[model samples]
Target: MKPGAVYFMANRKNGAIYTGVTSDLIKRVYQHRNGLVDGFTKDHDCKKLVWFEMFDDLEEARRREVQIKKWKRHWKIKRIEEHNPDWDDLWFDIVK
Candidate 1:
């Protein structure tokens, strides 16, 4: 359906932070949660879905993802705060 750049905030409970962009959020997150995908996320246990932005264009989403990747930690936190001020784990919200 919609092309999106979804980033996950990985942590047991408000712990580690992980940012990622994916076209398919559901499948991607499932893999992260299940530890099917190895690397930074799996090693750090960063499975909290915090903030995500949807874009109709894949190019736009990719552009945003790249931009975010270069952003400073505070900048990323500020961006996330725009929607999730409390930084609550947004895992269940997406499924509903």
Candidate 2:
């Protein structure tokens, strides 16, 4: 199978922003949701999956992650709003 990567944004139950990359989107997100991962997300309660982009190539995904990381807070908010105007958590939507 070709490698796939996802860059996702999470906010504290309703605050802050956390960006992350994962080859296994579902599992990684699950870890964050349950506080199984350490550092940023866990401490900040950044479990909501506000936005994500998928890529077939790891390098492309990495590049996108770097770009997003460097973006201004307003740009990131705009990016998320474009795809998820409501800023709703998308985790449950995927499994259904």
Candidate 1 vs. true structure, TM-score: 0.85
User: What's the count of clashing pairs in each model shown?
Assistant: 2, 0
Q: What is candidate 2's local distance difference test score? A: 0.78
Across residues 1-96, which tens digit of lDDT does each residue of candidate 2 receive?
345565554764235888777777888888989999999888888888888888887677777888888988788788788888888888987657
* Residue pairs in clash, model 1: 10-46, 10-47
Question: Considering only N, C-alpha and C atoms within 3 Å, which residue pairs clash in candidate 2?
Answer: none
Give the root-mean-square deviation of each candidate in angstroms. Answer: 2.1, 1.9
Poorly placed runs, candidate 2 (over 4 Å): 12-14
The prediction achieving the highest TM-score against the true structure is 2
Highest lDDT model number = 2
Off by over 4 Å in 1: 12-14
